[model samples]
Target: MRLAILAAYAAVISTATASYAQQSADPSGVWLRDDGNARVRIAPCGSNICATNLWIRDTSKGEEAGDRLVMSLEPKSPDTLAGTAYDAKRDRTYSITVQVSDRSLLTRGCILGGVLCRNVHWQLAR
Candidate 1:
C-alpha cells in the first residue's frame, strides 16, 4: 500500500540522518603530538570517548609510555572541551581542558589537588 511504502521511506531517511549525525559529531582520529614524537588514536568508547596511545618515536619508552587512557569530554563551548585523564599507573586522575582549532588541539593537564600541571599542544594527523 502507499501508506506502507511511505512509512518505509521515512524509516530509511531517519536512520540515514542519525548515522550522519553521529559521524559528524565524533572527532575520532589519529592525532600527532606537538613535539612530533607521538601519536594518539581518539575514538568513541561505549557512551563516552577515549584516546589510546598509538605510536611514539622512542621505541624502548613507547612500549611502556603509551597505554589506553580513558577520558570523558564535555564541550564547555563550541571550541573548548574539558575532561579528566585517568592514569592507571599513577592511580590518579588529572583534570584536562582542551581548546580545539580546526586540526590543532591545545591541551592542559593539571594535578587534581595542586597547581602543578603540564600543557601540550598537538596537531591532527592526516
Candidate 2:
C-alpha cells in the first residue's frame, strides 16, 4: 500500500525531471548589448546556462566588465530563462528574464522589488 504509493510517486517525479531537462534551451552565443557598450558570451555551465562578459567598447569606465553577468539560470521554456543579472557597474543584482529569439535575446532586469526595470534587446554578434 504505502510502499506501492511511494514507488509510483517516485516514478512520476523522475519522469517529470527528465522531461524538464530535455526541454531546456541553449542560448549559447556571443550577444551584443543594445547600446553597444559590451558583449556577453552565454554558454552552458554544468546543468545551467551562464553568461560572461566578452568585450567592452570603452576602457575608461574603470569597471571590471570581464566578469560573469549571469549564472545558473532556470529554464522556463525552450525560448525563455529566468535568473539574476549582476550589474558590475552598479554592484547590484536584479531579477532578470531572458527570452531568446531568432536573432536576438530580450533581457529584462528588475530592481526595487520589481518596481523599476530595464529591457535590453541583445542582438547576436557575428
Q: Rate the local accuracy (lDDT) of all candidates.
A: 0.75, 0.81
Q: What is the TM-score of each candidate against the true structure?
A: 0.70, 0.77
- Scanning candidate 1 in windows of ten residues, the lowest lDDT window is 19-28
Per-residue lDDT, model 2, residue 82, is 86
**What tens-digit string does per-residue lDDT give for candidate 1 at 1-36?**
999999999999999877655544344688898877
Clash count in backbone of candidate 1: 0
Model 2 C-alpha RMSD vs. true structure (Å) is 2.7
RMSD of each: 7.1, 2.7
State, as a TM-score between 0 and 1, how close model 1 is to the true structure. Answer: 0.70
Worst 10 residues of 2 by lDDT: 63-72
On a 0 to 100 scale, what is the lDDT of residue 56 in model 2? 80
Q: Over 4 Å off in model 1, which ranges?
A: 1-26, 59-66, 112-114
